[model samples]
Target: MNLVALAARCRAEHDYNPLCDAIPYVRFLGISVSEEAGEFISQLAFRPRNIGNPALPALHGGVVGAFLETTAILELVWAQETLMIPKIINITIDYLRPAGPVTTYARGTITKRGRRIANVTVEAWQGDRSRPVAIAHCHFLLELTP
Candidate 1:
């Protein structure tokens, strides 16, 4: 199925499994989404394969980055009812602390939105939401269906 149809199905069903399953990397990363208080929260289930530093036992920087980006994308889709996938213009990630070997949660907020573009900020936390492991600012080009 096309992304537009897949996203519609996800919204109608209030489940993101099919949407995540459509993306191989997202499925491999064990990313899932849930609604909390009318907001979307994304989770990344910890896995041994995601460890970048075996000694420090930290999640790979790339994995964390991907998780943040995915969260942003999902939020955009949910918030705007996007008809197509948002194309990334750019992303800047700040690693605040090492992501411990634990499930990570992320929330993306739309900082700004225009007819053709959107700015999103995402924060990922391992245990304490107050102490974020990483934060990301992302810009995406939205392609709305007419």
Candidate 2:
């Protein structure tokens, strides 16, 4: 489905699975979203293929980074009632700690949203919300329709 159609379905059904399903990378990473207390919480399910270091059994840095970015994009989509898909202009991710072979959760907050740009910050954690394994600051270009 196209992004516009997917966005319509998401809004109609009050679900974001269609949006996630439309992205192959999001599917490959096993990323899913749920609404908790009026906030969108994204989850990265544990998968053996995602392990980058067999010795440490840690998730790949790239996987974590991608998850965080995806979370930010989804948050933007969920928060806005627009059909446009936010395009990532740039993202900076900080790997605070190694992610173990387990599920990870992330939440993104929009620091600023303008007519054509948005800034989002995301935090990914495992087991504890207070301690984040990774954090990301992302800037996306919003497509404004006349």
Candidate 3:
């Protein structure tokens, strides 16, 4: 779905900005959706600043995990009729390369969906899409109501 249509749909169906509410800490980054592209229908962009880095100067692992989860769950939030807030069941991340101090983009896809569970895969990239800096596979627990 288009970005504006998606936003309206979120407000109509999910009651508020699912993107912002779900990923509040990353809201200042102004991360929004790009067009539907191939396997992934939406995208999120984040450039790790000095503050987001670890003591040793590497991108914080928690940020990577949050980015991946937000991107994946959002895709589902937009696609499904009844909004479901996904819980983290499990996540496996592979850091192919250290996230550099550049604009990093993330794309995610739902690999499998069950009654109350879903599997999602995500990749974060900078400059190169084919060679992602980090990749993640997550098992999600989705519940429709609070």
| Top of the candidates by lDDT | 1
lDDT of 2: 0.90
Candidate 3 has an lDDT of 0.65
Q: Residue 52 of model 1: what lDDT? A: 95
Ranking by TM-score: 1, 2, 3
Spell out the clash pairs found in candidate 3: none
Q: Which regions of candidate 3 fall more than 4 Å away from where they truly are? A: 1-8, 11-18, 28-30, 37-58
- Best TM-score goes to which candidate? 1
Candidate scoring better on lDDT of 2 and 3: 2
TM-score of each: 0.97, 0.95, 0.71
Local distance difference test scores for all models: 0.93, 0.90, 0.65
Clash totals in order: 0, 0, 0
Q: Which candidate do you rate higher for TM-score, 1 or 3?
A: 1
RMSD of each: 1.0, 1.4, 5.2
lDDT computed for candidate 1:
0.93
Evaluated at residue 69, the lDDT of candidate 1 is 98
Q: Give a tens-digit lDDT track for model 3, residues 37-124.
A: 4343333444545225655456667666667777776666655622555677898888888776556678777788888888888888
